[model samples]
Target: MTVPVRPDARRNATPYLYGREAAAVARVLESGQYGHSDVTEQFERRVANWLGVPEAVSVSSGTAALHAAFLAAGVGPGDEVVVPSMTFCATIQAILATGATPRFVDIDPDTLCVTGDLLMEAVTDATAAVAPVLFGGRAVDLSSVQGEFDRRGIVVVEDAAHAFGSRDGSRPVGAGGTALTCFSFGPIKNLTCGQGGMVIPRSPQEAERLRRLRLLGVVQSQNERADITTYHVDSFGLRYQLSSINAAIGLAQLDRFATTERVRRRLWRAYRQALAQVDGVTLVDVDVDRAVPHLCQVRVPRRDEVFAELRARGIGVGVHYPPNHRQPAFAAWRRSLPATERAGAEILSLPFHQHLTRDDIDHVASELERALKTTGGS
Candidate 1:
């Protein structure tokens, strides 16, 4: 099959198994119960076990996971959450959804995550939480910020959408932190469920609250509530529960996650080896042995030109994000995020997926090298 020039626009995951996924959907259709049910609950338990968390609340999307994490962590109106300006717009949107302000922080140039210094600088009297996203599956030094936040009594919510199966100092992404870590199961993620996400709470109480909040504040119970016949609203909530069908897909994906991760690591290594000799290109910082990279991003001077050149040469390249602060919606909160702004201009994500072959990696590297050469790279 001829691969599309742009990776993002192409079907990279399990192209041969489209029929099987269709069959799964068909099975769900035959079942007739489409919304939250036993399948969703099973998937939640499975994911919780996978993350080694007490509970995992499946949600409609990764954005929902963020919103739920913020709410469950007691973030509210007039509060501020420190977030890296270098992330996707959805991160900001989730903060805004909670009636909280997102205080944009600069990133560490090497790791592409919120730096300890920048995070400390962004903290203020109104700061309620600090959300550090693990960019491109690399483990960030959040320990320092965690210490600072602990001293100040601030909540930490990890945006681990890119770091599933990743470890920080021998602990899993969601483990050993007071933060509520969220994972994405979007189609393009390391483990996809068509469209879904999960929040791994820091405590059982928090996890219970998340579960309740996800399902419109309906607390789970074996016996029906005495006031089940009456209307009661103890707190605000949302309709963010994941569908059973999506959960089923997530379970299937989880079963294959280990094998997929191995393939992805090999592919990433091959790319790194092939592109290592190229000048004016620096790979993102990642502890290869511990990190199960979700994407391969590089810092290149002429990112746009190289991206366009790669596309023209039948290679797919993607931009992880444009600075969230630069976006019109968050412009009012925008400040001088030098590292984030610079990285936004320099970062380019190369094609990466479990399905990509060594030949594909070679093609991508060769095309990237040519693109850089043509764009006047030294």
Candidate 2:
């Protein structure tokens, strides 16, 4: 039997839970070890195995993941990181946390991702790294220019926060072992650990460095520390370890990710088909065949008015982000990004979650069509 849509299409996004999530959390609570424990390590191991990688380092949040990655890659004061101005503010904030200056660049309006040419053009002698955000779960390929980046000693730290199960080609997003890829299991991501993130390191040494960084520079394991009089502080770090409680939620979610992938892809395709009938809307291409889509975004004329109209009609609509270059906080790093600014003004995210039914999608599309007409955008 088909399940009815939950509530109205008023939530732009929400965490979709499997039946096992509660029991998994309860199991962790009953174990008494709430901090980084066996469960947390197990979650790490499972994530590594799922990605077909040697190891995965768990951290507190996606921001922490990026910060640790930059620190581990030796991105520090005076070093510049090239990034897209169209991404969420968190991406830029993480770069600042590393004491690196952001050299903001533009994105392809179609994919909302930085191209190899854009990244290469932005790189200079002081460029320490380039962070390509896999916006809306579409992978950004830098293979054509990867050798040049390596020659220049520029690390590739991918913000795969929106792309957990996505593919760069045939392999999974992080499975290629080239870039230091970060994944977020935040509340509304493809997978939810309640709030957690993982970093797939390029090497074992890098993986070890990440572990120490997340654990406040502690060299000893939780069990090892328990038996020791004092543990050594190896270097600078943060209290960014993923907790056992959150890891439990992640393990439960990971077990059922196949279903999650299927449902997300199906819903995204449904939106594409439905939105095809709606005029004056361009659905952002997520390459649904290879991506487990994280958002259903569309560009529209008269976006603000159309957004207001949709909200008034009880349909959820939102903007993914405003360009960070235009924000007061990052104004010093600002550059003229015509494409990003134009996209920022037009982009609107529609209601997208596993809770949505086909009827709900149709309702949103129908409302959007009416809104465009009312706003004189159609």
Candidate 3:
């Protein structure tokens, strides 16, 4: 098949850098105090202000953020965390890191997110927490069953790695002050910090707990530790602190978040409009009006064949995930999650990033339609 090349569509996802990122990193490099310095704290404060939250704790990675949140919430051995099977493996790994088993739940296939009803059905007496994956940057609202969770003393920790700038109703995802929301500033996420994460805690106490957890249980700041001969370890923790280098990149990215938000939404909508003309393709809704969408995905017939065909044509099509419940590593806790399994087989993530143009979206949609027809899907 002769397919016209689209260079922009050759990348599934790439960081969109504002001009200042290089200079920011240069400054951090020159400072020589890279490990969790004042710059890291500044980035946390800036993020909290942007999210309209009281505190945001910086971490080394999204997995570390999840691990810290699980530990801070008192989730441990003999406990179960309710989570969607459609999320990244890191979410499941984080649960296991806490010595807790994951009670895999199904998602609303259209949104690729676990609904309150699904989570409620999966919760048992052994359930210690519920970690909802905000797939494709769409916020998962668990408000309908909040009272039940409260009554049962079940903590809500959100794996909002894809939802950094998304909104739930009038407020941003982390600003709700309900769940312990985590955001990733990975290379391809809406905002790039090269690699870093943040946890938005519900209260000052939880914020302190997260801070301590990221810094290997140390109660003193780096400067304070330098002044004192000895530092105190208050609890069990990990070396998950976000370094000044990563924080510098994040701070620069944050300075241009409004542009990032606008560009991402526009790119997502372009894909939506173009994909509409392709038969047998169901665009997984991201609630784009309120979301700074992180991925443009679709449920297509013969997804594997379509994925292969797109790749052959140099279109950057990929799968968001294969259901975690079906993975061998998580076999012991796996259950029959019909919705998640079905979506796993059919979902395809298209090239999504700030770098793609409207023309790139059109080319991807056109090539997708052709691939579907060639695969006897349309």
Better of 1 and 2 by TM-score: 2
* Each prediction's whole-model lDDT (CA): 0.81, 0.93, 0.92
Question: How high a TM-score does candidate 1 get?
Answer: 0.92
The segments of candidate 1 whose C-alpha lies over 4 angstroms from its true place after superposition are 1-24, 220-232
Q: How high is each candidate's TM-score?
A: 0.92, 0.98, 0.99
Q: For model 2, state the Cα shift of residue 347 in Å.
A: 0.2
Q: Per-residue lDDT of 212-242 in model 3, one digit per residue for the tens?
A: 8888889998889888899999898799999
Flag regions of model 3 displaced more than 4 Å.
Answer: none
Off by over 4 Å in 2: 1-6
Q: How are the candidates ranked when ordered by lDDT, highest leading?
A: 2, 3, 1
Instruction: Give the Cα error of residue 126 in candidate 2, in Å.
Output: 1.0
State which candidate, 1 or 3, has the greater lDDT: 3
Models ranked on TM-score = 3, 2, 1
| Winning model by lDDT | 2
